[model samples]
Target: MKTVFSPLHAGHSGNVELIAGAIVPAFEKPSRAEFIRARVESEKLGPILPPEIHDLAAARKVHASDYIDFLPTVWPLWEASGRSGSAIPFTWPTRGLRGDVRPNGIDALLGFYSFDGGATFVKGTWDAIKSSYDVALTAAALVKAGEPSAFALCRPPGHHAGAAFMGGYCFINNAAVAAQWFRDHGAGRVSILDVDYHHGNGTQEIFYRRGDVQVLNLHGDPMTEYPFFLGHADERGEGDGEGFNDNYPMPFGTGWDAWNASLEDACTRLSAYAPDVVVVSLGVDTFEKDPISQFKLKTGDYPRIGRRIARLGLPTLFVMEGGYAVEEIGINAVGVLTGFEDR
Candidate 1:
């Protein structure tokens, strides 16, 4: 497997997120990708390549144009406003609020475009965001060009981001963009399997009304996890997408046994869907040592997850998502890829 990575991700550093009722350093950081890259090299997994330059054309298909426009403007607006710290949204237009209005002030625009406080921005954030998108698109291109599988080592992980809102350290939904890229490039059908600790709420909403792409997620239960509004078992697609979306929401402290059972069922359904290509939203935050997540998956179990996905026997793209256990991230994430190759 060829790995697509970008050093620009280092620019997205020094960010913060609101957790436990106070602001602190974000768990999603640049070292997360570096550690994974080091592991890939030590294991001789594959050659690591820099991302190819890509435009907003592919991302626009998965994200809202206004939201895409809002990204590059974040740093400039913050700098011009004389803000000294990383830009973070503290308010939101919630239920009964006027969601249709767009704010003109920097502070208001931040809140308007973000769903929570986690998607904060530093001066180099915009460049990093664009590079992350480029990384994902380039890896998708590799798979489209006949590579059996590729790993998109994206930073500032993108799963909680929705069509118009950013949150959970995500600015663009990289996996969703890659899935759509496959479809636009002549794939008859495509499926996304998000194995992150948190539900891929953005992915679910992006394809909720379309039947051509299938989205499945295995994560912590929304009732007790981050991004709690979506990921319910009953959130079956709304229109043409009905019955195409599935969620395996496990409770806290879920170990490999129960988790593997859910993975087995999800894979069974994915094989039945029979997509032309598969995109795995690979996240190792389910590792027992992940600080913010509660799953009990150990480093050794990652390969099993990879082997099971390999059973599908379709071209696959592994797009990085969440995984904050910096030191062990590479061992677990690459374990999945090595496992897939072993199969």
Candidate 2:
């Protein structure tokens, strides 16, 4: 598998995030990608290439233009508002509040565009955000050009971002963008399998009303996890997408036995769908040591996950997502790739 990466991800590092009612150092740091890249190198997984430049129009296909415009200007607007720290949202328009109105104040706009305060905007955030998008697209392009599989080492992981809102340390939904790029180019059907510990609420929402792309996710149940709103078994797609979206909401202490069972079921469904390509939102946070996630997957189990996906025998794209056990992230994430290659 050829891996696409970017050093620009180092630019979006934030100092703090509010977790468990207390501020702490951001877990989604640049080192996460570095470790994964280092492992890919040490393992001789494949060639590591820089991302190709893609037009902003490609991103607009999956994200709203207004949201895209708002992201790049966040830091400048925050600094202009006399803020000294990283730009974070404190208030959100919820329940009965008007969601359609766009506020002019930087503080209000931040909340308007974000679901939570986790995705901070630093001086280099925009550059990193765009680079991450480029990385995903470049890897997707490789698969489109006939490569069987590729890894997009995206940072500021994108599973939580939606078309109009940003959260969960994600700005643009890289996996969603790549899936859309595939459809727009030539693919008849594309399926996204998000294996992140957290539910891929963004990817599901992006494709919930469409039938061309199928979205399946396995994650911590929403009742007891971060992004604790969606990701239930009942969130079947609407309209043309009905019965196309699937979510396996595993409980907190889920082990590899239960998790792999869910993967087997999802792969069976993918076989039925027979998409032209598959996009795996590869997140190893399910590892037992992951700080913010719950699950009991071990390092040795990752390769099995890869081998199972490989059994499908379809072109695949592995886009990096969350995995905060920075020390072991590489072994677990790359284990999936190596397992697939071995298959």
Query: What stretches of model 2 exceed 4 Å from their correct place?
Result: none
- Model 1 is weakest, by summed lDDT over 10 consecutive residues, at 82-91
lDDT of 2 by residue, 1-343 (tens): 8999999999987657767887777888999999999999999998999998887998898889999999989989989998876888888999999888998899999899999878888899999999999999999999999999999999978989999999999999999999999999999999999999999999999999999999999999999998899999999899999989999999999999999999999999999999999999999999999999899999999999999999999999999999999999999999999999983
RMSD of each: 0.8, 0.9
Residue 103 local lDDT, model 2: 87
| Per-candidate clash tally | 0, 0
Q: Which ranges of candidate 1 are over 4 A from the true structure?
A: none
Predicted candidate 1 versus true structure: per-residue lDDT over 77-137, tens digit per residue: 8989988678999888999998799979888999998888999999899999999999999
lDDT of 2 at 194: 94
Candidate 1 contains a number of clashing pairs equal to 0
